[model samples]
Target chain A: MEHEKTQIERHTSKQFDVELEDVREQVLTMGGLVEQQIANGVKALIDGDSALGEDVARSDYKINTMEVAIDEACTKILARRQPQAGDLRLVLAIAKTITDLERIGDEAEKIGRMAVHLAGKDRPPSAFRQISQLGGHVRQMVRDSLDAFARMDTEAALAVAQHDAEVDREYEGVMRQCITFMMEDPRTIKHMLDVMWSVKALERIGDHATNISEYVVYLVGGRDVRHLSIEELEKEAARAISPRTGQ
Target chain B: MEHEKTQIERHTSKQFDVELEDVREQVLTMGGLVEQQIANGVKALIDGDSALGEDVARSDYKINTMEVAIDEACTKILARRQPQAGDLRLVLAIAKTITDLERIGDEAEKIGRMAVHLAGKDRPPSAFRQISQLGGHVRQMVRDSLDAFARMDTEAALAVAQHDAEVDREYEGVMRQCITFMMEDPRTIKHMLDVMWSVKALERIGDHATNISEYVVYLVGGRDVRHLSIEELEKEAARAISPRTGQ
Candidate 1:
């Protein structure tokens, strides 16, 4: 009787591990969706495509649904498995990650709307150039952060957070230029501001990526580098940025 | 033997409910911390106080630490109790909420940094006016969404989500103004964009709050509102959004 019970216990534990992987996999799947949303949202803006923006808006629901489903899965696992130690940490981090992905999706959708709005506008060369530059940095940050998340790489995550500060400096530059544009032609305020909103959305996306990196640190190393300097963390972080993947 | 078993089962179940409540309470505590972080971060920015921004920077770790702790708590309860149905949803939603709060905190911190950067500069009056408007909306959204959440009010959550569109509109206006500002005087691009970044931070805060409100709907009514009209969801979500303190 004791031997049989032990065998059943081992089987149950294995089953729990499989289920935990499923939850992680689902959260990762959702991460992919949110990442796509960010990219597509940015594309919609740059391409001046309202249809693309609308698609992004529609996809937000799927993102929201995935979030709910993943939350359910993690909760169910936690309740059933009573996982301790490392498993517990992994489950908790994924749960936190779903929330990050969902927000990232929203930012993407916001970008879509901005794209639709900006598609027809005539933009100043200098102002447009910097706006585009800020957007590019922000988008790269999102892609890298998501990669850090998938690879369970704290180093990549830290790099993503540090990258945000540079965007900040650029954003500062963009705003100064925008102000002059506004002063030059009050008529320009409407279009130029759309560019500004898009940059801001991208920056927030970067912040979410940083948050994901922080989660990576907690998941693997079990250390929270959130309050510390990215400079310090980067000193020890993987020197490479999270691979841009398809580039 | 049967009587003893029955008594033990009832005792254990009650214990589970209490622990679940503990998880819910902790999630709230985390939310409160992040919310305060955003407020302080924004205030730090507005006042040009590096100290306040530094304070936000300092608080990031604690927020992250608390996130892990609460996530652990949820996983622990789920593992040990194996809560079904409603209890499971509570654990999961609270877990998701931790993430949203952390993002909100990060956005606030970014705003604080921008505030510090802009402290030394002369900002456009119109830009400041719009920034204040966006800030107020975001701040209100955060406060009321949490209130709706604490109360499990779906209507409140829907209301918050609806308000997000308004913030978007404001963001659009700010962007237009900034772009115009930069065109006329390239020299002001940096300062104008700092203010714009701060506005963007506030707008993202509102987005996070809206996310919190959506989760509130799922938790309270178990309904999925991802694809529905706001009007439909608002009407159907009464049970979810209604303050259910008595219930």
Candidate 2:
């Protein structure tokens, strides 16, 4: 009878572990969708393709629905499993991560809107170099941040945080170049405005990705590095980002 | 024995209601703090109070913490109670509403950042009328949206959605004004750019507030009215706003 009771306990505990795994799988799935959306949205902007932008916009609704469904699923697990301490934190982190994912989807839609707006306008006479450079930086930030999340690399997350300041600097540069174009030729204001909006969206996407990276840091290290300076943050990031040699 | 079981169930069910009431109370408490932050952020902007703006920015961390706590509390209630149907929706809506509230807090901080950036410059030379109008409209939306949630007034929620168009229009107007300001006076360009950022933040807060209203409407009506027309939205808003005086 004691052996049977132990067997039942093991089965229930295994089931609880399975639920946590399920929650993680959902998060990674949603993360993949968001990553794809970011890539597609930026490509839409670069290629001047409204059709691709339309696709990105359509997928945002799925992210919204997924967030609701995932929240429900988590609540069910919490109710049935009655996870305490660390298990509870893991569930809470997943819930928070979904919110970040959904916001990333929203940022992608904003980029899509800009792409749709810019569909009719030609790139300005000479500001493409600066805009393209800024785009490159933003794309890199998004990529690195997501990679950090997937690998649970705190260093990468800290780098992502540092990258944001540079992205902001680049955005400021783009704004200045666009301002120059508008001042030089009034007709370009419309297109330049759209470009500025797209740049803003990319910057926001970078911010959200950094947020995901921050969450990974928190999950791994159990510390809040949100408001820390780049140098101090780098140590935590390094510790988190470095892969262990063995299990 | 069955009758004793029935009485116990009734007692627990009442306790469940009490728990739900606690969650709702905390949600509103958090919402009230967020609304005040938005108000203070904008007041900092209008009054050129950079210190106040900094205060708003610093306090955003507290808002984020409050949000996580509220979310955990709501999920715990949902899980422990295993609420069905309407109770489920109410809990879910509260969960969703907290996300909107957190985003609103972010928007408020964005406004504060813009305020600090614009502080070095003199007052807007471009009338600044639309931004002020939009600020008021969005503030009212935040205030009344929370009221609708507290009262479960679908009519008030609908009205909030209808007024989103006003916010959008104001955003467009700000866009144009900033573009023209850049074109007409290159000197005011930097300040106008910051002003546009402030207006953008306000526009988004209005959007989030409208989303909360939509949730309230859906929570009560159990229908998706996202694509509904402005006129129909206003009718629903009227009901939520007026509360008990419909006769």
Candidate 3:
């Protein structure tokens, strides 16, 4: 009887592991969808493709649906499996990660909306070159953050978090250029405001990605790195992964 | 022996209720702090009180600490008690609600930061009248959302959610006025941009408040009201609370 019970317990534990893995995979899938949204949203804006922008905006519902589905799965896991310690943290991190992902998706949709709004206006001479560059940088950050999450790599997470500062600087540069354009021609103010909104969305996307990286660190390093400096995060990550810690 | 077992189970369940109540109360306390932060942040900007703005920015750490502590407590409760059904949803909603509250606090900090940046600039004759009005509107939304959460009043939550549209309109008005100011005299571009940032932050705080009210609807109504229109949300809330449903 004892042997039989142990076998049953082992099988249940294995099933729980599978459930956790399934949730993590779903989160990655959702991240991929959001990344595509950001890319298409930015492309639509820079290329003045109203059809693509509308498509991108319409597709945001998919991300929102995934977020709700994934959150339900996590809640079910917590209720049924009663995850403890590391497992509990993993579930919690994924829950928080999806919220950020959903918000990133929202920002991308805002970019798409801005693109549609700007499509009717005359394109400026710079043609949003700076926005294109910043968009690429923010997109890379989102991808890298998801990569860190997929691998549960604390070092990679820290790197992505640190890269947000560069994204901020790029965002500021875009804003300055928009202001200059608006000043040069008062007629451009309305159009430039649309561009400003798009870049602001991209900048916010970078922040959401940084938030996801912080969750990765929290999951892998067992530390809440939300408000910490990059240097502080690095030290915490090192301590978490050190040989003496036996993590 | 059966009677004794029942008594012990009852005691455990009562303790669980106390734990849940404690977390809820803590969330309300945190909400109160965030509300104060928004008031002070906006007041600082409107009055050009650098000291007050600096204090609001500095005090954001308290909200962060509360968020971390509340999240940890929720995790512990989930691990130890494994609350089921309604209890589980309550815990999950609180978790999500606190995330929004923390973000609202972050927006208030941004407003405070912008205030500090603008204190050195020449105040425009209009003196941010639109921003002050929008600030008051958003602060009320935050308060009403928290009140709804505290009472689990779906009608109140829906009202707060609907009020966000007015906040958005106000935000747009401020943005348009800022553009006019910058266009009239390019020299004011820098200061106007600072004012614009503050208004943007206020707009986002309204969004965060809407998110919180949505959570209240989810928790009380047993439905994910996110991405739903106010009309649909009202229908869901009514159905969830209907006597025929026997909730």
Query: Model 3, range B122-233, lDDT digits (tens) per residue?
Result: 7765648878899999999999999998898888888998899999998888888888888888878777888988889999999999999999888887778898887898
CA error at residue B42 for candidate 2, angstroms: 2.8
lDDT of 3 at A245: 61
lDDT of each: 0.75, 0.77, 0.90
Give the top-scoring candidate (TM-score).
3
Model 3 TM: 0.96
Writing each residue's lDDT as its tens digit, candidate 3 over A1-247 gives 9999999999999999999999999999999999999999999999889999999999999999999999989988988888888999999999999999999999999999998998878876564888888899999999999999999888888888889999999888878888887778877887888888898999999999999999988988776888888889989889767854674
DockQ of each: 0.33, 0.23, 0.70
Sorted into a CAPRI-style docking class, model 3 comes out as medium
The CAPRI class of candidate 1 is acceptable
What does candidate 1's lDDT look like per residue over B14-37, in tens digits? 888788777777777877787688
Evaluate residue A8 in candidate 1 and report its C-alpha lDDT on the 0 to 100 scale.
94
What is model 3's DockQ versus the real complex? 0.70
Comparing 2 with 3 on lDDT, the higher-scoring candidate is 3
lDDT of prediction 2: 0.77
